[model samples]
Target: MAFKIFHPISFIFLIFILLAPLGHAKRSTPSDKTSSAFDFIKKLKGCHKGNHTKEIHELKAYLEKFGYLKYENKSQATDDDFDDILESAVKTYQENYHIKPSGIVDDATISQMTTSRCGNPDIANGTNFMQPHGNKHESGSSNIHTVSHYTFLPGNPKWPPTKTHLTFRFSPNYPVSSVAPVARAFHKWDLATHFTFAQVGANQNSDMIIEFHRRDHGDGSPFDGPGAVIAHAFPPTDGRFHYDGDERWSIGSVAGAYDLETVAIHEIGHLLGLGHSSVGEAIMFPSISSGQVKNLHPDDIQGIRALYGR
Candidate 1:
């Protein structure tokens, strides 16, 4: 066996190589990325109308992205001034989230805004579904009436009436480990509704496409990475369900990780024509916290039933 000897310069190069991996080992965790994205909101906690700061412009953009603050033109939306328009938008957001409609960026509002949520807009085409109607209707028993909190996308787009059975295929870019959890989500929906979902091969054409994407992966709605937007799905007939690839995803309720099944189920609701529910307990609720696992709530069931009856 031949022994290799290192010269002074070569030995120093070897030491540097050994230390390089250690120096680069400390990578930013998913939670860190998620929190960092919305850290600006924390600084703007006490901010309200008439407060002209650059951060307010970020807040306005955040609101506008989620369909709260709307402007006629691009320039108006980009302004840093928190005018009456911004105040009204804030109030609407507060009312929707069950916070006091103070029209100010309070602690509660800041907390809610920083939470990881779906990428879909709460208000679609000027229609705000975030406001819970609590519309009461008779249940199976005539005496028993239930209040509904579910709403639909603008125009209530849905699959064709005759197209009861749907085929879904995972995009080639989807994480292989995620297939099982997503399948379970489809199964749950199948059990609850009249629709049946079948998974096809990736190469085959399918009615719905499930994929993981990062920021600006097309479809007009770009994802905001980890914290702000976890995932989004299109309404029926345009079955494009996308998960933010930057999110820390997990199979179960793992700390600092979003449960894949919970998100899948929520997105599936959108794919099936159901919108966000004001009822926090519903799976279709706009936001979910890390380590939280939510099953279908009564609101979800009622919403689907209302959209497509048995």
Candidate 2:
């Protein structure tokens, strides 16, 4: 998890998200042990850390840095064999993710055991989009993905590039609260070593226009009421990006709500010719937040690079 300290949210988080089908790792409630590993990991303390006699301290430190983990003191340690506990934790993670659970300390297991992750976004790199839950991010991301890639990648303009840049003509029609986060998101991309080529601004002259209203715009995508889904976009020629005004567009987790800027960044990822990444933890993987990088993940970078060749 991102934070060293565990979030005090209802343990149900395990049920709603962590336990959902994501990869091969399935964390079913163990009938033998009273509580399931989901329950156990949930109580593991977002901040507590046991000794480092082994290299597990790195995992503890990562959880601490992100502030999502609760380290348990050795005394609080489970009576289960250390190996079993580790196996169970990995299994629970795998079960929750739907990854093929070997139960052995394989690369997938170690990847989960180590990488520092964002809150609900605590998925490892190589597998984000391949998982079912990860697919949630790409529900409406096709336009941006296909369009952007067709224009900028090796395939050449499979579709005609609108010589006219419509992104500049439009202005940001979204809520004012979104302006800062939108700008922040853009700036974050601009800050990336690989984002140097991308431009920012929301007005007509800008490379892209972000809107926040509902009803069918020029493009076919319609914003559902806030919450469930907040926005969507068309590929290059569309030059139009939109947000569902109903959402509370913020930079943080919303309990059950989605983040506006995060969504915007995702849509923006679409606009830029990148496709949803199959890698589970990638920004392009279709969803991310909590422990996900506020900026583009490396695989996102790779995809964009493949499209633009930079």
Q: Pick the candidate with the highest lDDT.
A: 1
lDDT of 2 at 174: 29
TM-score of 1: 0.86
**Decoy 2 TM-score against native:** 0.43
Residues 183-245 of candidate 1: C-alpha lDDT, one tens digit per residue? 999999999999999999999999999987777986898877666788899998999998877
Query: Which stretches in model 1 have alpha-carbon errors above 4 Å?
Result: 1-34, 134-146
Model 1 lDDT, residue 302, Cα: 86
lDDT of 2 by residue, 147-264 (tens): 1211121222212333322223224332333456666566555554244323455432555676656545446544434222345655554456666544333345433334556666
In terms of lDDT, model 2 sits at 0.41
Backbone collisions counted per model: 0, 58
Against the unseen true structure, what C-alpha lDDT does each candidate score?
0.82, 0.41
Model 2: lowest-lDDT 10 consecutive positions: 147-156
Candidate 2 positional error at 262, Å: 1.8
